[model samples]
Target: MYENLDDAELLRAALDAMNREHNADAVSLLKILVDRNPVHPYGHYLLAAEHMQLGMVDRAEEGFARAVALAPDFPIARFQLGQLYLVKGDGALAKSTLAPLADLPSGTALASYAKGLIAMVDDDVSGAVEALQTGLACEQEILPLAGDMQRLLANLMAPTEDGAFPAGVETTMSAAPLYLSAYGKTDP
Candidate 1:
């Protein structure tokens, strides 16, 4: 039923399905889109995001990597890919994947998020919290991503079993998975 649709139409349908939480349908449509237009970075990104929502980490990682490879300037794809790596406990790879985002303006959401993630990797909980707060302040486009940052910040700030705030990366890493299922729905 979707074969006849153009790339734009297919993306629209996929987005609609995602909006309605019909991930299977969205994945089907996005797969067709990427199949028809193999170099479309957005298609791969969306497909990867749906994969993430469904907990298909490997496929999501591959799709996000493909999207970033195809469009190096696509900050959202790069950020999400790095985030996936961080959640998977690959700090080095995550830092590398998120490195390019540093070129973005310091006040931008992606830049701040990248800084936060990198700080988390470096075990700087205070720095991560500061950067995430900055990101949240300027983040209006991708609400879901902001929500993820907020959750991470909350986790970092929360006291441990001994009533002391987490002093290392453990809390951040532990809370990372909770935000994985919350993919950004905005078109990048």
Candidate 2:
């Protein structure tokens, strides 16, 4: 029962709370926004993200579905929905959801990242390695994901004789490869 705030104001407050990691407050603001504009796709998107942060996957799924239903062309929400599907072990659904995004300029990196994760989850080691490598090449800002992706790739590309990791794979010289590439190496 919010009194006078408009959708933009509520959205602003939600973003502020989300930035502060105040997920509960973000959810409250998003709820008010949704109440005010149930058909607004972004409201549902914010709610879904907050719910995901809170580990309420079922509710998050519902909100994400609502967002997609309201605006099927919304790339970011669809990408996040695909990620949720991946987390739920629904590889087929995740791939299907993420596939269309690959064609959009804004969605290219996200689609690649999701596909890479899907490949990893399916134990398609070589495929994951390739996808992750391409993802990194396409979007270096995905460096945060690069560490785990590199670890996974290293394990996949490891020699199968004794199942030991291949050389230069076990240890990383940088957690932020993009930053390292930009600034010329990191401390560790």
- lDDT string for model 1 (1-188, tens) is 87789999898889889888888999999999999999999999889888887878899899999999999998888998998898888999999999999679877987998999998888777888898889988945777677778877887776567644475445555455445434545554
Candidate 2's displacement at residue 139, Å, is 4.0
Per-candidate total of colliding backbone pairs: 0, 0
- Can you write out model 2's per-residue Cα lDDT over 1-188, one digit (the tens) per residue? 55677777778777777767777887888888898789988888778867766767788788888998999998667766776676676878877887777656643555566666566556565666677667656655434445545664565576566534344432331222212111111110
Cα deviation at 157, candidate 2, in Å, is: 5.9
CA lDDT of each candidate? 0.82, 0.64
Give candidate 1 misplaced runs (Cα > 4 Å): 159-184
Best by lDDT: 1
Clash-forming residue pairs, model 2:
none
